[model samples]
Target: MIVRITSKFGAVDAVHKTPHTGVDIAITEGTTLRALGEGVVDRIYDGSANIGKGLSIKLDDGTQLIYGHMNEVKARIGEHVHAGEIIGLSGNTGNSTGPHLHLGMKATDGSWLDPTHLADKVANVNWINGPITQIWGLLREKVSEITIDGFTDYLADFIVAFPVIAVVSGGVYALVRILSKGGATWAAIGTMIYGLLIVK
Candidate 1:
């Protein structure tokens, strides 16, 4: 995995899905949407372009990405923008169902690659602390990410070690009490140490 996962700002209603030209990612509305790369705002459309209330930025990389159904636009037309710059906010404006960014990346030669494949590379810095390896197992249908198999082992180890530790210390204290004090004067110390050491 590379980095951030950016996609559809919301759900795609029936009308949008009828055409079925994009993918949907469930996210919160108004999450700070960022540019995947340095780009010039080719055009900022608010329910004007065929993309529906979205904006398109033509990056210097010779690739353009269309961000649709935005809640707010932060970039202006013909403005130079850097990668990871806040470009818009997620919203359900036009032909969108929920809150998520739907991106359409176009190459100079006109080829489309799956966004999910490169989602990590362009994602936010949170990827550094992402539990992707552990999370993927949850999405992939693993029944035992956190299993009780080890709990019993750990508890058993603790149980077995506790008595030995307590007994050794308690025996030393009791021996010291007997040798130092002698007679019935030290009898209470032996019983006290033994009682304190044995829990069950």
Candidate 2:
């Protein structure tokens, strides 16, 4: 369940005099927040300041990851948390205009780093493989709502149709390849067909 990104890192808006330091992911209040990677809870602070109730984790690489504007903090200081582990709940706390999770990253040198592309770096890390996985469980619950008999029937139909689909796809590929190298006449015909099918 990917949520909408309400605000990106370095974005300047009415509320910000300088560029925003973190990415704001719009989520409903009480939405579960997860750790970005294996880290130990280093700081947990509550205040009416911009960040509101916040939590910081000291990652293995010596950098720190921060989660802010949380309605609740689940991790305690000095507690070790693995990737995707629940650390808090999203909220419109502090200076936030709406409910969202403010995720920030700090380098080992104590400089703020852009966290917008952090997902790309951790794309291979499955939430299901973590100790506190919730995504797959939620997906399972949704999938269970569908009838098994209907799903199996669709699967069977797909299995029966796969060979025909494969043969047709292979033939199309062969035709395209041949047409691509077939000098003038075939190229003209292929161009006409391509224009009709793809280029309108």
Candidate 3:
């Protein structure tokens, strides 16, 4: 799963029978929601007084995740969603006091399990390419913040420099390939000869 749910699961509300079944995540309405792992969409529901617009997806491992209170369901029933794929947008459509995401999980036996338990499995992004994921997230945020002029300036500089870099790199690669066919001593001799030739 994506491991991006910002809030922990809590006790189900006895009155709602909903909160008791799922965890409420504090999210802004319309925030993009993503699948935590590759899964098939099992169900989709329109907004009701309680559940609102929501979707249920069964993971490859047979665990089912329930996402509720979404503003829009982007995935369709029986569609396969890849890991980290955007499945919907969060919202307060059902019986919610505020905008948030209600998430629930079920085991293969069809019994409701605290989504938190599954979340625990992904608690440590640091262990599973977490740093790279974090870097990518940060980079996305940064790139989004760039203005059109800023992007244009960077693009111009890159366009100007690219050919020069490519030419130099290609020449170096050719030299290295030629020298490597010989040995280290020959490589050194070739480098010295090339240096003299360049100077001359």
Q: Which pairs clash in model 3? A: 1-36, 1-37, 2-36, 12-19, 12-20, 13-19, 13-20
Candidate 2 residue lDDT tens string, 49-148: 7899989999999999888898999999999999888787777788888766788999999999998876433322323334223333333433554588
Predicted structure with the largest TM-score when compared to the true one: 2
**Candidates sorted by lDDT, descending order?**
2, 3, 1
Distance from true location, Cα of 115 in model 3, Å:
0.9
* Per-candidate alpha-carbon RMSD to the true structure: 18.6, 14.1, 15.9
Q: lDDT winner among the candidates?
A: 2
Q: For candidate 2, give the lDDT.
A: 0.68
| 1-200: candidate 1 lDDT, tens digit per residue | 22223233233554454433444443345556777778899878777554556677887878777777778898899889887777877666766644455666667787654455434443452233344432342233223322587456645655776666566656666667666756333444444433332222
List the candidate numbers ranked by TM-score, top first: 2, 3, 1
Output the better candidate (1/2) by TM-score: 2
Backbone clash total for model 3 is 7
Please state the error at residue 15 of candidate 2 in Å: 1.3
Clashes in candidate 2: how many?
0
Candidate 2: worst-modelled 10 consecutive residues by lDDT: 191-200
Cα lDDT, model 3, residue 47: 90
Lowest summed lDDT window (length 10), candidate 1: 137-146
Clashing pairs in 2: none
